[model samples]
Target chain A: MFYVPVSSSGGDTVNTGAAITPAQYVQHHLEHLTLNLRTFRVGDLQEAQGFWVLNLDTFLVSLILGIGLVVFLRFVAVRMREVPGGLQNFVEIMVGFVDKSISEVYHGKSKLLAPMSLIIFMWVFLMNAMDLLPVDLLWRILDLFGVTYFKNVPTADPNVTFAMSLAVFFLIIFYNIKIKKFHLAKEMLTVPFGGYLFPLNLVFRLIEECVKPLSLALRLFGNMFAGELVFILIALLPWWGQGLPGGIWAIFHILVITLQAFIFMMLTVVYLSMAHDTH
Target chain B: MGINATLIGQFITFAILVWFTMKYVWPPITQAMHDREKKIAAGLEAAERSKRELEMAERKAMSIIRDAKQQATHIIDEASRHSVLLVEEAKQQAKEEGARMIELAQHEISREVTQAKEVLKTQLATLVVAGAEKVIQRHLDASAHMALLDELVAEI
Candidate 1:
């Protein structure tokens, strides 16, 4: 439902409930436009939408954005010359940055890590930037097209965050196993205490290994979710009142999104480093 | 709100992105960046080398110019000295020619005066013979007196 913004500046609208209840508005905003996995149809059949459900909004947004990112980087990649120009200079700045970060952390000779970090940072930054959009804008536009329950920000969705984290998690496990070989298992048993406490060490190591993806996912999901929530709540404010708090939150959220993306990339590189080095 | 099949889709999307990045995006851009870095380093090195060469060339040009200036000054001084020596030689030749002309004229004048004096001596002996003949009131023999005249001339 499209919202009619505040007309009177003197009073509050959340309590007044003009077109719909604020609770309903907030709930409607939070819901994702989902595709039922079992039926393989994009519908709002709430009954069977359980664990078999897919958030189509999340999937499509992430996919399109992911492709967009690839195309963008590829565009820069192909157009790169010995002498850089306008767009080339800008993209190269980012490329140089990610390259340096990768070099700093992961000393191993792998080409994918910088690109991977570039994708994560830029794509996540873009996804998280959706929170900065007027929360009702996409929904209102898409609602006009008979689509409802759209959550625009992909990073706000736990699935997307988890997907990225899972990838990083797999990389960490892969490199640890690939590089350390038998030594990883040995360290897993005997690092903290002694070899006599191998059982306790194993349990501790398993928990620690499980926590990496969980922390990365939840940290990103939590920040973006909160940012999205704050924007929605700000949109709930009287239109005249929304400007100040909304602008401030957005200004602050820019830092959050960027920092979150950077942190995700940084942690991934660090994990890669840990997996790479013997220590 | 809940974990579901979206994770699989996202993971699939994630996988595609990772593949695309690794295949197309990462390696080429990384290579381009590395290539650009090497190019820049090479360009700088070339620039530095050319700069050194330019400096050396400039120093050499300056020295050449200085040497040319020195040679020019030396040539100018040599020309002036030669001109001065030529002027002195012309003056010395003019003075020697004037002295020789004056000596030739003086010698001719002295020789002419001696010849005139010898004529006067001969005339004076003839006059003395006439006067003696008149005083003795008799004619003297000229042929006999010729030898006397010659002797007198010698004495004179």
Candidate 2:
């Protein structure tokens, strides 16, 4: 149900040079640059229906930004001064903020939490912040190079968000197993209801476990995707008309981006902490 | 878009990022932050220690000044007592010197008086002898005059 096409109803109007309808414009912006990697034949890549088709644009943008984030952070880390200034100060502040949040929420000593939280927060933030860029600007640039179907905001994609949340989900399960040991299976079959209701308890436990990553991924995905949609929708207006609403939405989106990133990081910490909790 | 291999690719990317960050990006920054925090705490502790040491030094200086003042007063008191003893000794020596001079002068005056008495006695005995000689020439003798002189000297 969550996999339904988010693009509005519109037929492809490319090569016609005719002004695209609002639906077609939104659809064009919604399309991802994809590559089909299936060994056997499947639906076309343009349809995004193949199970093995990769969203090239999503991976490219996310990979580039991820590398940029690491490089920038490494630069700051390498040259970090006792008296921090500029980029180093900014990076340190972010690092400190993430560390403090994880320490506060995640009481158990997992060496991975702080760094993981930092990566997710910063990566998600950078991806979301890409929405603030003028949507038409990148499209026009790509159009100049004879390219279309590029979505720059990686977090807007459910796949990317799901990938991150799934990673976190695995960590939660791993921690549960590590911390609870043999008791985890017992608790899953017993808790909230008694052992007598083991079957119902297992179902509920599965749902509970599924909900953590689902909510985490969907929350960020929904917010960024909506924000990106709004930008594309605003871009559909006359150039002059786009200014006021676009500017207003962009300003409001700053809050959305930061909040979504924070929510994602907070949930990751909370879930991992819950996993570490006994019974 | 439909779910695709991008999900797996993204998962790979995420894993790589997590691994890279955990290995390289996260540690140094956090370490720098921790190092800075420790440095700040050490600096604050040092400041507190120096402040305590300064207060102690001031207290020590005050005590030392008080001790020096007490020592100076003690030295002055001792000097005054020594001066008083020296004045008393000088006065006693002067009194003894004055008594000795007076006694020597009295003795000399008595000696002079005795000499003058002896000369007068000589002159009187000569006159008496001359008169006795004249008288003896008319009435008495020299032996009797000598016995009279001896008795007169013994009476003086």
Candidate 3:
């Protein structure tokens, strides 16, 4: 028989070093590669490769969230009628709310923005909801299958969130191009600093576009990662200390998770709306 | 950190989810909401009908009560008229009976008075006859008195 050592702290027994020190565990989860060694190119910025790597947790969780979103939507679709039941009713309320928000932000036509906003809300909500799951659950399951190092939350990973934001950013750019064309860009460059300073105008606009994806990704990743951290710290508490506080925190977290998802979805809709706008 | 194979998976998942939600979910949810609203409206209509029926029943009850009161008043008036007629008939009959009785009593009295007068006249004539017979008997013979009495009888 093997004995697992559980330590008592603050008058409550907690399962601690039988696994790993709190700092090491947190560090292992937090650490990211400052640079991507494989993507190294001479022309690439010197600071790029050493930049923090993608957080695996955020990516995996987001994938699950995406699937969950589809399934939920499918279920709602199956149950739709001339009259709504419980789940259908709830989904309608959510859709209506998201639709209203998009309508308010994106004015020209409801056709594109309405559907897009609904999609964003449900998808991001699904992603944010992923934080509700225990951080180690997937890892433990994977460990059973001999894979010990799987992180399950994709939104927490800077790379994945940034990638998602960048996709939206690119779509925005594409729409702007489609709406305004080359003339639109020329006009924009000529407006603020005048056509004479075209170089600076172009440079500034490029920087602005680049920052959109970065901000979008960082915002989502930061909020979700913080929530995850809170949960982890709660889990580290002993018996009454850990269990009670963890329960309390988990309850509060339900709102945080849902809110974060909603914010992310709404922002996406706003960005898309802005992209479609003319001036 | 790097653009690895995972990015492909992520993009694929996003596309699939968006497609599924658009195709499978939105139409039905909208339909269900509409149906629920219709059902609620129907229920309200049903409630309104029942309310109208209740009002009609209430009106019917009031009419029935009004009719009963009217019938009762009519009966009372009829009863009063019949009683008056009965009393009037009885009084007329009583007056006729009294008149008849008085008439009969007057006739009897008249008859009695006439008979008495006749008796008295007869008595006075007999007395005068007796006195004349006495005088004639004294002055003449019995045969003469008889002859006189015979003549008197023939004349009457």
Specify the highest-TM-score model's number: 2
CAPRI-style quality class for the chain A–B interface of candidate 1 = medium
Off by over 4 Å in 3: A1-19, A30-61, A110-112, B1-3, B31-156
Residue-pair clashes per candidate: 0, 1, 24
Off by over 4 Å in 1: A1-20, B68-155
Evaluate model 3: give its TM-score: 0.60
lDDT of 1 at B2: 73
With a 3 Å backbone cut-off (N, CA, C), the pairs that clash in candidate 1 are none
iRMSD (1 decimal) for each model: 1.1, 0.9, 4.3
Q: For residues A9-53, what per-residue lDDT tens digits would candidate 3 score against the true structure?
A: 111122433556677566444433222345532112233343333
Best by lDDT: 2
Error of 3 at A142 (Å): 3.7
Q: Model 2: iRMSD?
A: 0.9
Docking class of 2: medium
Give the poorly placed runs of model 2, Cα more than 4 Å off.
Answer: A1-11, A38-47, B116-156
Ranked by TM-score from best down, the candidates are 2, 1, 3
Residue A194, candidate 3: Cα error in Å is: 3.7
- DockQ leader: 2
